[model samples]
Target chain A: MDADKHFIVGVFDDEEVLLKGIGKIRGNGVKIHDVYSPFPVHGIDDALSIKRSRLPIAAFMFGMTGTALALLMQIWMLGYDWPMIIGGKNHASLPPFIPVTFELTVLLAALGMVGTFFIASDMKPYKWPRQFDLRSTEDKHVMAIDLAINSGKTKDELRSLLRDSGASEVNEKSFE
Target chain B: MQVASSLREALITGGKTVKDVSHDISRHVENKPTKLWWAAMAISVAVMAYGFYCLCYLLWEGVGVWGLNKTVGWAWDITNFVWWVGIGHAGTLISAILLLFRQRWRMSINRAAEAMTIFAVICAATFPFAHMGRLWLGFYWVFPLPNTWGSLWANFNSPLLWDVFAISTYFTVSLVFWYMGLIPDFAVIRDRAVVQGAKIRAQVYNALSFGWQGGAKTWMRYESVALILAGLSTPLVLSVHTIVSMDFATSVIPGWHTTIFPPYFVAGAIFSGFAMVLTLLLITRKVFKLEDYITIYHIELMNIIIIITGSIVGIAYITELFIAWYSGVEYEGYAFYNRVSGPFAWSYWSMMTCNVISPQLFWVKKIRTSLVATFVLSIVVNIGMWFERFVIIVTSLHRDYIPSSWTMFSPTMYDIGEYLFTFGFFFTAFLLFAKFFPVINMAEVKSIVKVASLEKKENASH
Candidate 1:
């Protein structure tokens, strides 16, 4: 295995332990590469100091785009291009246009946010994700420490630190 | 950590650990289809085949094959359209509305409910498309696309045009929401498949999950995206049925032209939607042996929603009558009077009894909690809601100001067949989903188990 690709992985069976272990492991001068679990462990982000996601901001921008596009489309189509009188109403009535506008706004916001999430998280079809431990997707919470990042400590030192911080098992992983 | 009040009832019972949740939910997906599942699939497929035949024959014969006359142009088609759309509401309501309220009980049931919504919307869209009689050629005409026909855009001022946008957007957004939730659960299945040496299952689920790794950063983004989607869907679901109601409310017809249609229709949609949810969940829990996850307490809470919405619908019905009488408008008065005592008074009374009266029985703790009663009453509520739509469309149109064009509307065999086709499609899709996909939101449900289970907390502390 490449020296740079070496990692010390800790497996946790309990969410509470994993959460507290995040802080304890980091406190011992070990930088966590990532923590993987079967479900979203509440407050794990704060524990890992992961920044809050900007997905909602992206959703809002997309929603605004939808609103503008919808209004422009309706106004351009009914007002300028081929206006027809249906209910003795105006050519481009705003009230009648609201439903479609609302629908499009929601549509764009949802789809856009989902797309952004996939991109931001690097999630996509056929993308083989790096599973430090497959059990991380099951009952175990797996925390990975990059050996290169924590070169100050030996492998044995990191492994014992993980075990002391509530890890049931500590394993070494490396990738080319 | 979320700590449920000591006094609160446990959301997940049967003393489930994280491993048990994964095992219990994924086993259904990982294992071969049970004999009951095969039997259900066979029946649904047979119905779908028959319905497909009817749809083909209808397409070949044209709109004249149905009993649509000049007066009652909108009968079963519109009724079924509204009914299916209304049924679609509960999924988003549970996933979105209840989510905003932070109701943890929704975790177990939202997956199936949202799937039902997708299927129901597909069923709803069938009516308007099939009613067009030449859907193959004219389907694209609904969209405001730049066409060859002189750039003659679809009428923006028309509710019919607005419906096209509304339903399509609603379906797309709901599908995205449902699929997003399924990703993490799919990852769970995929990981289990790897351990069990099920290569095909692992590959399929991995692709379906879009290679979700469940990393802390990814999960943080996933949660934010989910929350925003839920916020978007809440208003989107309400707007969908409100626009559907506008199809009638915006019209000048005596019975149809009521300002109360929007709120009333939305309430009725939720009422019928909850009934449908109850109908599906009760069977799902029993068939999948998920009794512990979807406990009787969940049923009781759902029943309470049914009571609230049902009473609202009942009040709307009465208020419509009172307003007709109070307005002193002969046409409006005659419309309500005819609805009560007219030739089709049977449907009106059926609507009242089934939707208004039957759900009220849920007030009795015994009836509401009993699986048999909820199952039976849920079907009753759906049938009544169907009649409610039928009575509104057919009765209102059957008697116009001019007696010459006024005529009774009756459904041909094709009408009934088209409806069966939708049922077949819905059940077939749902069964396939239940068999293959995780029927419960395993990820979400797992998140709550530690907090929701008092025993687990106690055990942990010990």
Candidate 2:
């Protein structure tokens, strides 16, 4: 809860400027917090040293939940609850379960993933966002650098690094 | 050096400002429809009206208006239901499954296909509801309702009940997926609106958007929600058709009672659905002049899927035949033989040629890229897939058990009327979609432009 944290933002016209700026910023031994662009910039993750997303793991877990729920639901309904012979087939057959199981697996996985996504991303219905620059959605590219540590020379160094790396506009803001 | 120079060249040449992309898409939206669009819309509307009239007739009278009998109870109604449902699958597959795979080509056509999925599912749902004879009691299909006819419970083992659950689930999931994709594009339209009415529409859109600021948090949440939905939908989409397949596979009929039906049905669903997508995209891309966004690369990718799924269906056909022979069940064996060589041999051959042989042409790049060839092939695939269902349901049921009960079924005017009306329902929804929301996912397309920009950036560094 550092109330006096400062953020340095570098705006770029396109991805090339952003990439070049990233290189220079990282080259200056400044720890890059995050880079925001209108769309995904390839190689930005590697350049910014960001780790691979854990969303897939979440999806896998969701899929597993779906699979388990589907199997158990079928087992309970067909095996234990009022089991009746269908088409003279065995009561405990797995083939009939395959279709619903597959469907449920997909259903559970999808619903679980969506739920996790909303929770992780903090998106909810009708929530108004704070501090938005509309052009970012349109076309403008932006790179934000949080200045949590280091002031004075380090601040100047980061700003000059962004400028030298072809940032069209550099702005600094104090966060509450 | 050559790569570097080429990269630099591409960067310079391909650097499209935000204004350019907006201008390109807006140009299409702004321009009034040409003569052809008017002609097409007029024809579609006429057909749609006729369909509505027929539907009204069906609704007023009973489903007895159609050619369905005790033996062929599931005739045109079920066939059209399954057909449209199968057609609905490709849109979700293209949008959700392809999104997971990070296929950039999906950006151009996903919106249209998703729209088609909603419309087609709407079309598909009408039949079962209407055909229920007691269309007013459609709510009884869902659980937790006390049956008016004593203490009878909905049979859990019944595939029909499974179908109710499946179709309703599929419809809900697909609607959410379609609407979620629309939010950003709606925001764009909202921002760009100038006219008073348009501005009001924009305000409504903004309200619907829930004040999306498109911040990192918003994007992150949107992306995650979309991904989750897509992941959920992928199986949901697959299950819908699989459940539809179960309606056949779960039965005791000779040709229908096979374990392979689910996969086969799913494959056929994708095949027909892609065909429908191709058909719509072909017309849309040309009419809307979305050639740049829905590039030949996208078309080629769809073709590849069409080919693969078509082949999977072909293999399923062979497998069905093989399993029938292998099972040594005389009725099943005869069903297979009768399908291939009986009085309905023409239908079987048509299914084989249209579905199996036509898609094989995609193996050659020339055929896959050719619009005419692809369009014809898509039509063929649709016809073939429809026949596949028809052949499976009709041929098997026609001669079941006794030869004396054997009957040849023909579609009356009512059957054709119901069928045409479903098309009307589908086209009307699509027409409304085009008039309102963007035919392309603008945000997703913007993302692709970003990726292309990144590619150019990489080359510049080299």
TM-score of each: 0.98, 0.81
Candidate 2, TM-score of its B chain: 0.92
Please give, for residues B389-429, the per-residue lDDT of candidate 1 as tens digits: 99999999999889998789878888888899999999999
State the iRMSD of every prediction, in order shown: 0.8, 4.2
- TM-score of the A chain in candidate 2? 0.87
What is each predicted model's overall lDDT from 0 to 1? 0.92, 0.74
Clashes of each: 0, 1
* C-alpha positional error of residue B111 in candidate 1 after TM-score superposition, expressed in Å: 0.4
Task: Give the TM-score comparing model 1 with the true structure, all chains together.
Answer: 0.98
How well does candidate 1 reproduce the true complex, by DockQ?
0.88
Q: Model 2: residues >4 Å from true position, as ranges?
A: A1-10, A19-37, A40-132, A142-166, A169-176, B1-19, B26-39, B142-144, B148-151, B194-198, B322-327, B450-462
True contacts kept of each: 0.91, 0.23
Instruction: Show model 1 residue runs off by greater than 4 Å.
Output: A1-4, B456-462
> Which candidate leads the pack in DockQ?
1
Lowest lDDT sum, 10 consecutive residues, model 1 chain A, at: A1-10
lDDT of 2 by residue, B304-380 (tens): 99989999999999998998899999999999999999988899999999999999999999999999999988998
Docking level for model 1:
high
